[model samples]
Target: MDPVARQTLLAAMDAGWADPRRLYAEASTARRLLDQAREVLAQGLGVRPSEVAFAPDGPTAVRWAMEGLLHAARRRGARTVASAVEHSAVLAPGRHRATTAGDPSLFVEVPVQPSGALDLPAWNAALQVPGTVAAALQQANGEVGTMQPLEDAWDACRRAGVPLVVDAQACLGRTGAPTSYDVLAGDAQSWAGPGGLGILVVPEGTRWALPGPPDPDGALSGPTRHTPWVPLALAAAEAWQQTGATLDADAREATALVDALRAAAAALPDTEVVGDPVDRLPHIVTFSALYADGEAIVREFDRRGFAVASGSACTASTLEPSHVLAAMGALTHGNVRVTLPLLRVAGGRSEDVARFAEAIPAVVAAVRAEVGAPRW
Candidate 1:
């Protein structure tokens, strides 16, 4: 769905364009408006305003949060753990092992089912390993819309004394992070905010070590007295508030669309819909047509004027299926992701999803025909 919130954001930006950190009266007004935004975020997410800090975008937030967890591990011991479903930004840094020559690093990944949620048995086994450190999990799947058993898995981490780092990039404003996690990270763009904005929230009393370009004074990214990046500050607040109000409606529309799409998908000879059929996000659908190159289908739909995402939209062009989908051990290489937004009053209607659903058959059919799949 198209978003009207863009207009709202543009207008807000026009009005509050002054630098929020400036000492002058105009900047002071921007700063005051930012405070209310932070309070809204705190209220919406059930955390204090001090816990949230804004970053450039989702990947940046993911990196920052992972770094904090890694620093926490260094303070306590020397091991780090995560899941197979983690985003690339989180997994890449954790792969390097420090040795006697340096600080060796090692990683253990909890497996997931083909539907993309965590594999409970595999997870329990991984966390039980000796010298287990922090664990990372995503609240929702950007590729498949499957939700990990976060509260349960996070409770396991807590019981094992392993701090849990969560990627809430797809969950913030839709399904806010569960409070049990040690570190929370997400991008604002997924929720219709500006592209270059993300949030990293550290709860009080978490032994996170953040020594970097943004935070070196033993404080968060913002200075001790004031914060920077107030537009993100405002985005977080407004998006969450708007999401809470329209979640049910959006979910209702998306569910029906998914049901229809799943029925249409099943007609294919060797294809399957991945992710939980129930208990998942309302906004996304992921499926794989066996033996079809994902890029081919992506191009077919792109020509059809349907803007679909292949894997996580932002990270897909790296010539790999999402780690989340790969971790699920499903049909990874030939998958497509469909997303619906919490649109504004005039932006989209149920018929739009239906039309998109109707278009999918033609798109897939064209792709299959082009690939020489037998027309049965």
Candidate 2:
């Protein structure tokens, strides 16, 4: 998180630690701060403050938005469509809904290009299905850094009379939020703010409903309806405001680093850089090594003083290969996902990027040799 955001949170934690739903003085102050945060988020998203709903985090907000849209669409039919490359949070609801509806295919998965681009044609076709109600296509992918054709996807959903929920967690502060989405979801932590703050934008008159019973005002209610913590929300707004002010320069610098990393990864033996080389996120890059394990590679890098993530089972309980890698038909093993900070305030620096790049090939090769993996 940005230092400013961090300090703001620390300060808020001290002063705004009251129940915002209550009518006390402390609660009133907390409510005002929370409202101010919501206003900032709404302005950034080009929506009204009334349209924004705060959740515990991004995934929860996504679940709420998805369930709401899907439930609202039940009148038309209980079917929805999404890109195969969507985050698990976006896919989980449809799967759960499908299970409850007694049909495994209640959710249709649209194929994506090897470059990680969404298959607009397939998405449109899925929308034409008799029971289709809402569709989900992420603004940009978190794993592969691929930017989806959102305008085109939104157009298709519009033509089919289906509401589109865009998971904008990856693109909100990095590239600015897209203006075309009917329902937008994002996370505070993604923009150098504290976690536990999820941003949900529900445009006025959007065809969406909560999965459960309605509240006193006829608004949809979920399992939890308590307002978010005042400080976290305020810090998120402050961080987002800062990100917006410096995004252009930060993006250029981060993109240069990513470009360099991409070139280095592509040049490495038995390695393939995944996602679009040019049309990807400015701060994230992923690559896979042949004949090596992703966890092994991540460990090797960590030992060498660089923190990186892998596409393979990150923990002992989850041994499944990344669905995102599988969707792109890329090597799932020996995968490394590197995400750099977007600004100096967030510890983003060219020196760190250079250090990581310089250490990559050696660490990867060392891991490969330890595993007795063959080089291509």
Candidate 3:
């Protein structure tokens, strides 16, 4: 973590640690702080704090979002569509289960451009499918870091009378993109907030389907009198306010780095960077080196004191090609995903990044030399 981020966390932790549920002055402080957090977050996301419901974490937030969308749109029927580049939660095959007569409920696969934008033609066609209740897509790709055209997609779904659910897990607050989604989900950890807190931004007046006693008409799940919910909301909001315009800066610098690396690797005979070159998210880049092990290069970089990420970080177990690249008909098995930390020193603007960029050719050369990529 960056030093400034760390300091912010420590301060937020100290101030937000008080349980807002307690019936005392400390509790009152916590409640006020938490309320302030939600308001701040709403300001950053261009929504209302009342619309933002905090969850325990990101995956849970996703589950709640999917199921809530299902319930909210249940009156329509059991059809859910998600972009092919959607996260695992939305891409779950279970959502497309077999029904009576052996025909499965439709789980339409809408294609997104390599740059992570919605495929308008496919989206238009998919929404026209009868019984289509809701659609899900990440606000941006986590692995590839491409921002989706949620505004346009949301508009299309609206025109088609379909509700849109977005997992803003990686892009929320970071990108500052406009969202009019029925359900927008994300986590605090994605933006340096404490773990165990997730966000489901549900605007007021939107109907949501939740599984439970139905005590309250709004909010995602759990009781309103919960502890830490208020604090986490407040902290997340404050963090967002302090980190405004981050998306543009991160996107710009990361895009430049991607271009730098892509050019450097292009000099090699059998190397290719994946994802859309432009109109993509600015913070992430992935590439595949033919015949060269992804882990080997990542490890080599780590050894040199530069911390970067690889596609499907669990490469040692399954060297399978990245699903995103595979979907694009591009290389996958030997792919690396570099996510630049918001702090510039983490290879964003300093020598750390320049050195990493400079080291690419040598790493590719060394790996290719060992595995014999190609002579030309």
Best candidate according to TM-score? 2
Predicted candidate 3 versus true structure: per-residue lDDT over 1-376, tens digit per residue: 3344456556766775776656788777767777777767777777876776767788777767777767776777778888887777677643444243255556777776656567888998889889888788887788777667778888898999888888888876456655568888888767656577877777766667576665443332232212345545655555565456465676566678768876776676677777667756666777777877777778777887766676642474565555566566666655667766665224445455678778887876786677766665
The better-scoring model by lDDT among 2 and 3 is: 2
Clashing residue pair totals per candidate (backbone < 3 A): 6, 1, 5
Error of model 3, residue 358, in angstroms: 1.0
Q: What is the lDDT of residue 260 in candidate 3?
A: 82
Off by over 4 Å in 1: 1-8, 97-105, 212-228, 312-318, 374-376
Instruction: Give per-residue CA lDDT, model 1, range 40-74, as digits (tens).
Output: 76676688877766667788788777777666567
* Candidate with better TM-score, 2 vs 3: 2
- For model 2, state the Cα shift of residue 242 in Å: 1.4
Which pairs, if any, clash in model 1? 97-104, 97-105, 98-103, 98-104, 98-105, 99-104
Error of model 1, residue 272, in angstroms: 1.0
Per-residue lDDT tens digits for candidate 2, residues 1-376, read 8787888889899778887767999987887788788788878877877788878898888777788787777667888899999888878777887889899878998999999999888888989988788888888899999999999999998999889999988877788688878888888878888888887888878877675555553222122353677888889998988888888888998899999999988888888999988888898999998877787787788887788887865422478888999999998888999988766464647888888889988887887888898543
Cα misplacement distance, residue 142 of candidate 1 (Å): 0.8
Whole-model lDDT, candidate 3?
0.69
